[model samples]
Target: MYKSLILLLLNTIFINVLWSNDYILNINDDMTAIKVTICSKRPLQLTSSLDNATHYLSKTSSHVEILNGHQLRLTKPDSCHWLIIPTNTESTAMTGQLLKVPTGLLLWRNEQIENDVINVQSPKAANAKLVNHSLPLPKINHDQYKWPKEPSFMSLFAYFGDFSQKTLRISEQSGSNLSLQINWLSKTLDSQYDSLISWINQVARSFVATSVLSGEQTVQLNLFASHSSESVPFAMVYRGEGTSIDAQINPQASLSQLKTDWTLYHEFAHLALPFIDRNDAWLSEGLASYLQYPLMQKASVLDEREAIEELWHGIRRGQTNYQELSKPNLTLAQLSSNMMEFRSFKQVYWRGAIFWFQVDLKLRANGDSLVRLLNRFNRCCRDLNSIWQGESLSAVLDQQIDYPFIQQLVTQYNNSTQFPQTDRLFNSIGISIANDNQIKVLDRPKLNRFFANFKAH
Candidate 1:
């Protein structure tokens, strides 16, 4: 009994120490500059995504030296180092000024800060907004707040400004409920607030239900309303510190139009997997493309036939892109690695969808499924901040099953210069292309059953 009690005491002490805040941020009243204080004496290096980050650093600091246009090096280690970063106020939106969490931008002895807490001291007029894996920050005092968990390297992106905020609590049947915090960065979105929130709630619930992810989760969605007439002009998901999405929406667009928009579904589907490296973007983009249609169908935004048609349309676009951009010697992996340089998005995305589609068919043949595998992955291995290489992700998934199918497919497709052959695969599932270039969904039992099972799931 004594030994157990001693062990428990030690564990409690360790937990507290591990979660202790290591950095303090003091922001000025105007939100134009931030002063950062590192709690540790360790030598620190700073890197920024900004091209002229050094120009923004306070010139009075002799200890800090410019390493490059994007990086800074501290000359000597001290008990505490004060770094000040100034913001370009004129260039940013009126809703918020982004003050990046510098603790997240640092390298301690040239390594990532894996276990540090960042505490913020800001003026009451300015609110610090950051998405992190930990529970919402609790205020120490009226002006002081600390992040409760170890900061994910990716979670360091933060913004400070006066903004409209709304929280939606979604109840889950199993595990913990999901807390979605929506930050409206623009006043223009106010008109569609009710409809927009409703659409987000529906899709978020649909995602959780379809993926079977029951963990208590928090998602921070920053909605930036644009004046453009387009609906949901663009959106991107960020992971590591926490799951957050930045979506540019048009306030003028109807809720029905928002529900049917493929961009939102695609971005939400990304939550199913860990952050994959950009070199293997084909895998990540492919998974999102493949799942988006089904997700829309499941959410009732698209019917069975409509979903299948959309899928076919995307696949055909991929095929057409590959034919036009085909390089005689370049493999899919090579093209995927330099995808941006080659503008091979359609080919990479669609080919990736094809890869997953084929894998799903194979899995279904054995009474297993991509959905089941993804559910299992979510339950066991899905870490929002964890970065995975393509083959490494495949290897991990392959370990979950009896046969090594995922890795085999990845290897074969990565090496082949040709686009994945899907004629036989589609025919086997009762989809065919007519000579008139239209896709026909055949009335075979296999195809009907596939659609039925898809909707039922």
Candidate 2:
């Protein structure tokens, strides 16, 4: 608790900066929370997430609370001065939970400011300042961390908005690197970043080898500090073709964690498909997760047996982390419903991967492969702006080849909690546990052929 600010309400002059907005965010000395004060000349009814359990606004009470409309109506009779403290140093990508991360970095915003209405061209804030920061975020030579480039859209999306912007600010700790930053040009790829991108290119070449997608691509790598060393706590891969393809990384992440983590390949695989809806995360995330393994095989990152092993582990992880619903059995329809109750994101990811795996196996049995189908899908809808859904995507995929694997999977898994069981698939490919508990290939002629044909050698 840094008690440096006073509760002065009389004769206060609001200092304005950046893009004409009177809002200014001052970092606390301890670097825990940011103090946001906006001196206004007129009355404004400020609205925050009052209904949310997490108020999102930590240091206030008098002017903010859930009422009839959940808006904090600020009646500025004479001089409207509002101050709110939004906690920034607590949440990080490493913990997956909002905890104190004391990186002294802030998400360039007055936490309560509405970015959607503010960042837009038509609805730009009336008096808001647009002092966006310069591009290629300057590198800070702090012993704690390093950011290779300037913050871009990803950072703005979190602090400001999703749509791309030209300028943003760090506000405090300019010379310090105590936080994570992911933007178009925020961080550069060196050891961990290089390894991840190399792996991506390897799989990408493999995908291209199958003649599915093109190889000429540009991906923006963003690195940030980590909260936990165990795994990458938070990451996101977004944007489409003609747009900057972005991937997030934790600079503090160990080489082993960075190399072994499937997040890179998983996100990288998403670039193969056109953008889909969040509700259909199963399709997008699942496809990426499943493809990562084979792509790893192409990169020599994981062998056939190791690929199967990874799939096995992913299945177990999805099963273990699956959120149980009221209906013990879930169908693809119920599972895909935007109704948050029936949705299990983990289940969707793995189960959707399993569906693809089973379909690929079945298709290969009938003299076809998943790569060919994906190639056709990519050819048909090459544009990212053209959003796709399950039905339309399935219809187009079926049109690609004689077999309709995507359609079949949707038909089978859309109604219940039937996740893919990889045991039989693995067994068919000669993957088995040896006496030492390591994965090995069984000496079966047919199985050897299955393994050989499963992935491009």
Per-residue accuracy of model 1 over 1-457 as CA lDDT, tens digit each: 9999999999888655543425666667776666776543445675553455455556425666678766666565533556776555332333344333322332222346533446666555534443211113333443344343333444334556555667776765655356677877676787878999888987877676664454656666888887777898899987654567889999889989888889988887887777899888889899999988888877888876678789888988998888898686888899899998888889899989999999888888888888777767767776633678888899888987887789989988888788887777778778787777677778567765665554213
Off by over 4 Å in 2: 1-211, 215-217, 240-248, 254-256, 322-326, 338-343, 420-423, 432-440, 443-457
Of candidate 1, the 10-residue stretch with the lowest lDDT total is 130-139
Compared with the true structure, all predictions reach lDDT values of 0.69, 0.49
CA RMSD of each candidate after superposition: 6.9, 13.7
Which candidate achieves the best lDDT against the true structure?
Answer: 1
Model 2: per-residue lDDT, tens digit, 98-172? 122211222222334432112111113543222121112222321111221111222211222121222111111
Question: Once superposed on the true structure, which residue ranges of model 1 sit more than 4 Å away at CA?
Answer: 1-23, 37-83, 88-117, 124-156, 169-171, 176-178, 212-214, 428-430, 443-457
Predicted structure with the largest TM-score when compared to the true one: 1
For candidate 1, the per-residue lDDT at 86 reads 59
